[model samples]
Target: MTEAVASDGNHGSGPLEYGERRLLHLQAARKLLTEGEPIRAVARHLVAAGGTLEPWAVAALREAAAEAVALSAEPEAREFLHTARQGTDSPAVAAELTDLDWWIRPAAAVGALTELARTDGLPSPATAVLVRRLAWHGRIEEASELLAARPDPGIDGAVTDAWLSRLYPGAFGARTGAPALDEVAATHPWLRADADPGAVLQGLALHRGALEPLQMSLLALDGAGTLDTEAGWFADLLAAARRSSSRVAEALLIAARARVELRRGELRTAEESAETALCLLTPASWGVLIGMPLATVLESLTEQGRHAEVPDRLRATLPQAISRTPYGLIYLRARGQHFLATGRSRAALGEFLAAGEIQRSWGADHPGLSPWMLDAARAHLALGEPAAARELAGRQLRGPGGDRPRIRAGALRILAGTVGPGRRPESLREAITLAERSGDRLELARCLAELGRAFTEAGQPEYAYAPLQRAWRIATDSGAGLLLAELAAGGLGGPPVDPAEARGLAQLSDAERRVAELAAQGYKNREIARRLFLTASTVEQHLTRIYRKLGVRRRSALAAIPGLVPAADVPRPGRPRPLCARPGMV
Candidate 1:
């Protein structure tokens, strides 16, 4: 019998020690797998020892090894399958093999698993895996057929049914005799430790009540990957919240809208929505949820080149993120974006990879939720690994998870970045079309800018004008000032910075300009606020607006522009300028 690991959430007897020990063993196992040890032998050894270990430890090994199969090479995948199949003639081992096959050849696994199920009745979990794989492969008919064969699939089987219902609505509901809907009700009768979004959606479809939609809306937003394709779903949720008169639901919907708008590149709209949400949901409440629409607010600010203006409240919320979950992954991803925006790609890469590892460990390595693959690919390109970047993007594109229109758009965008100029325009055009159709305004603007650049580089200035003009209009209307400036930097058709120097300077209010100048003169926020006779929060707000108008990220960027701050007033290194330095002010 396996030794049960005592988990009291304490030092040596709990989950902490168990996790540490598992990590040590995983490291050893990885090393062994790296060496010439046969997988069957390794499996035999681990299984024998598993009798003396906690169930979690054994399960950890299984999950990690299974992950290696998808993330590793063909030889490694085969090795993992070999180990899983070792010394097992039972239906359990057969089911394990079927799941392992999904990592390699999903389509092939479908037929084989179906045959196995027909020959000998399979367990519910195994059946669920088969159905999920089939749905992923777009084999809805076959999956439905298999589901129909099992009269009462139990709770585990309902998971498969729920996925099928959501993924293929045409085959469910009024069209398919409500089979999927029936299964949904069977599995989720109450709240449990695990949240199933599909089950929640089914409740909405059945007109269960406001509470289900409210709860489901939170989970949906929390798990919303890259694509804003769920705009329709959000719309439905908002309508339901309004009907139910749920203030909390309405606030969450506003927050979710802000997130979608941010993805679309509508900076001004996203900020407005996020502000509304923040007002409805207090900052304290935001901290508890770890998603107060703050991320979108910060992202919008950063993308508009107002990085320095990102709310202190937003930055303070990072520590509240719960790792090893979708919520944490998204937070980590946003933080990574902040790093990337500020030109810290190395740190960005770490966060992105951490998010990716968590997603992979959960077996939810889809592009819709995390899109860590695209982020990491971009980092690799920045790190000057074109081959690696292209390879990684290509892998994601070929996977079923990449089938979502938004994921495909993102993957193509990365591919465009990795490819040569000759191939960029075509890839970018496709990406732009997808982004536009998917309603991701920012991605569309970026792709348009890229395509215009590609055309200009190809010595077709006339061909570039149309795309550039459209991009400029979108960026201007969307408050995507950073994108507008980037177009100018790329030598597209945006207003020349040199010519607009005086106008840029005039755009800031008198107080705003003063704060900008003081900031540019090496005074910190406290010093500047003191000198201006304004609260620090007010000063920060002024700075954000000033950054937006002037299209600058930091005081340095503001100082770099001529006619904004006097050259002589520019802060130099070494000694304190003391422009606003009071006696006690350091």
Candidate 2:
């Protein structure tokens, strides 16, 4: 008889602590995850544990899969994720327990999805829609095949149509070229969670096809003002989803952002909301995974010029990211951005290349591609490859008809400065237009400040003041550090300091510069480890040494390293003076 024991958040007890069954095997596999154990640890361990695995053993396998993903061990993820997904609902069969999630309580909606998908005894519509939801999660392949496998098209249609309307809202309505819609009966419906019946009724207009589309739209809304009104609609749709034959509704329920309302005015609320969301959705993450949010938060920090904060955040979260997350692009992009911000164009280019590889794997027009292209262009420009940057930018912008404001503004600013004479006016005007349309007040402000610099460089300083002043106003109100830095550096803030008259450089080697540049760009020791192909500990050591040599105490100071930049008529060998702040105050 095996002892039943607990594994984090998994309530009740299980037969044997996974470790106790074959403690030696489990310990050895864990070491292999770090030390390159047997190269066949999973296989070797499975053999040792009697060809059958326990739940904790399964949990351990999942954990190892997670580590492999963190290490960019793509080969391992394909094998591991497939195995874990297979074990999701099996109560009697257990193999490896590295994932831990298997032994623990499965997240409500996700667990429902797993059970319903594998267990056919449930209602037809329930399992059918459940499969479709799984498809959308990008976990399984297309749901169409699963739907085809069912004998009842009517039930499948109802389930699929219901989910579709909820997912895309306004998109569900019929247009001249649209497919003919079969009506879903109002009485057999499951959607009843609406706080206000009128709005949803209006949105759906009693059209069954509109339900999933609407639900999808509501789920994607970002602003508080809109999300506030849409919350009840989401709840209703989610409620309907949960009650439907497919347990997939629980997936959406776990994904619902209605809780985001609780922290309308509080930043802490987002943190709490994210944590709760993570816990709520636990093991099964319908395609709406954690990587996106982690990337989103990191990008927000980049906008704030706090790029150095990325490592600590990643240290806390990366281990938890799903193996197949498309967020791989984002991780590399942020790493590149950190390097670019710190003036290491060449090293940044490597990261951009790595990110581009991942993004391209998804497709060129993938939404994530826009930002990655923009970052890649910046990297090229920093490396003094203006022609290459321009070519890439033109291709990307043309495909989209235009880049998003942030990318457009950045690309144009670079093009305006780098590709001069005849193209200057056209690029500057485009940059200005982007600055205006971004809606991020600070983003617009940075554009304006950069525009002013463009004018001054183009022998139009007299035309620069108005835009600079406008930029200044936006920055003061937004309190964005990067924009503030731009205003100060452009000499529109206060008096400018001479770079040569500034402090001296800390003696650094080529590798340290590479390390510092990436560090400044927000690469954690682990990310840096992967980039440099060195051990995580080695990256830390390099960072420590770089800090000592640079005379600055933290990774944040790498950007301001005076020695890194050639003297701009400033003195050397001292600490950087605090930058002049207020545009006028400076």
Candidate 3:
């Protein structure tokens, strides 16, 4: 018979030694098992032994497996379940094992689980997996119904419900109340102590629109000033994810880091991190959550001027349910930017407007989340509809996100384009100041470029030189090839011109000269018409006459001539003087 250890200190103890106390605890656990106590009563003691299963009873092993599953200790759970299975073919043990396996390798278990749900119905342990699967497949209503059928949905079910609530706030009839991160950690001591804390942290960060708590949590976890730097925090989180037993949790944490990197303008790192996260799970497994990483990758690629690679990246099969989430808005905006870069202004405008409609419907029309109005305004400007552009920019300026420096700067930049040359510098200077405050280098470059163009259009060559040079350096450093191209097309960054190109300046009328300068600077007839407030046909006629006078046939030949210099610098009598040639001359 196994020795029954004393619970009371009846063994005349002065003070028990460490070995004696451990032996006593082990014996007491065995005594409880022999006395027909429930396996759960002694399961913790047995698990604490932590070795080969030969010394443990089958019942104790099964209970240990269940406890490990609850704690999300996948490897320990698998080992205990395997040992228990060899001794007995208990269906409850098998179900627990299946659920454990389903968390990491859903593809292998989804078919069996689906059929089980259809027929005899899932055991409580398996229900959460099926619900998640249904939601992943875009059967959200069905998932909600199945979850509602279960009265006590357990810890896993509650976590899934919380994620769904955040991902699609109003998709179901009402919001499901989820426990806060602290509450969850307090209630489930096992999760707090043994399982990865990142799972809880990711759930809290999802769709919540705040990062202070996340940053604070990381600091607390790593001690003061240890993970305070962005790189350090990101690495710490990534290390935690790697050590986690759940692949889903790891992917979610990595994706979250990718988004943060994207916002910080670390494009290469964001793209790599997002790609790594996507590779951890299959597309169907990601469901609507795939949008987080996929959007980051798409936006990074698009911004880098690698437009040719975008179509293939976009060919992934996404769940239809993604369209209802904030992730979808990100993807839509990124695609619109791509369209604009590729000269599909009308298509880009349609995408931007569609995103705006969705935002309005969802009542999430905050410009900080997605400045679709500014995007639409940019599309309008590209389409040569400055009035429409101005209207949209003005509306954004007067709306919710207008107070944000970055959003305000974007609106001002667009507004400057639609206004007269006399007012353009003021709007653009304010835009430049706001862009600098926002710390977005790309935005600053855009504003500076516009200011330089305003100075150029006003025939203030001396004033244009400084802003254009500053913009050139910023654009080159930011890898903004599109902005660089725009600056180049505006005749801001080019070699010094030969004086001989000025010979035809005296032969053209003022209107014809304006058209000729714009043409030489690479503006199409429609674009020139928009800038000069003329019809396209009139601009085309002026271009034809200018080309004849300059002895040029194609627009390329026009570009070959040196860009417009100040009329005062031209050795011709018919040219007009610069508007802002010197200080106090405006």
Among the numbered candidates, top lDDT falls to 3
Structural similarity to truth (TM-score) of each candidate: 0.49, 0.47, 0.63
Residue lDDT tens for model 2, 295-338: 44444444445656655656643422232333345445656666
* Global lDDT of each candidate: 0.59, 0.49, 0.65
Please say which candidate is ahead in lDDT: 1 or 3.
3
Q: What TM-score should be assigned to candidate 3?
A: 0.63
Model 1 accuracy (lDDT, Cα) = 0.59
lDDT of 3 at 10: 47
Give the per-residue lDDT of model 1 (tens digit) for 1-586: 1123222322455544555555544444445555746544344335433322333334434554554443333344344445445534446557666655543333345567656656456766677666665554445556677677754665556545554443333343222333454445555543333545544543453221233344444556444443242557656756665443124456656776677777777676777777667665334333223443666666776777666665454456332324533445556677777778777889888988887777666555635546888888888887888887888788888875676667778788888877666788888888888887777787787888788777778786666766776787787777665676677668643432343555677888888888888887778999988887899999999989988888778767876664555423111122211132222111
Q: Show pairs that collide, candidate 3.
A: none
Residue-by-residue lDDT tens digits, candidate 3, 419-534: 87778999999999988876666778788888877877888766776687677766555555566667667864543243344457677899998988888777888999999999
Candidate 1 vs. true structure, TM-score:
0.49
